[model samples]
Target: MRFCSRWVVRDQWHEVCLYEDYFLYRTRAADSTAPPEEHRVENGDIADIGVDREGPLWGITLTVTSGESRTVPCPATIAAPLLLRWHDRD
Candidate 1:
């Protein structure tokens, strides 16, 4: 996968959006219109990551400081590209 852009805010993970010809993988604000927060990731930190693709849906794991992870389905706009790019990955 190739990343079109990456962002960090306030020294923590804010969002990451990876893009290809037909797909985009993004982690964005829940409100859609809210300004992105400031976070940063330093070296040696264990960043937990998860990805899921089922049927027409795609999901990614969201990890909090508490160690619990939540899998959230990608929105339709994102799902379309995800599926297209995933097949390309193969």
Candidate 2:
């Protein structure tokens, strides 16, 4: 699956997409003029995948082995599939 998103306000809009073995997400807010940031982690670079949900809002938190964490807005429906595919790259 392939998906892309434009810049959105912080804590407002978030989008996460899977492109083959690559994980792409861009939801910028620090500077609206700036393009969304793209993050890619190879297999084994991931430490954990977390979900944050409140009312109707949902987000995905990715923690890498380096201890860095990034969050992207995600739909509740894709949350499970994304987690499974991310961890089970095989």
Give candidate 1 misplaced runs (Cα > 4 Å): 5-33, 37-43, 62-66, 75-90
Which pairs clash inside model 2? 14-73
In order, candidate lDDTs are 0.44, 0.65
Q: Please write out the lDDT profile of model 2 over residues 1-90, one tens digit for every residue.
A: 544433344454455766665566655665466766666776467788788975444678888899999776666666766777766655
Displacement of the residue 77 alpha carbon in candidate 2, Å: 2.4
Give lDDT tens digits, candidate 1, residues 1-90: 343334332332333443332222345555456555443332123134446767554565544455755555644445455345544543
What's the residue-level lDDT of 19 in candidate 2? 62
Estimate candidate 2's alpha-carbon lDDT, on a 0 to 1 scale.
Answer: 0.65
Query: How much is 51 displaced in model 1, in angstroms?
Result: 1.7
User: Candidate 2: TM-score?
Assistant: 0.60
> Cα RMSD (Å) per model?
9.0, 3.6
Candidate 2 total steric clashes? 1
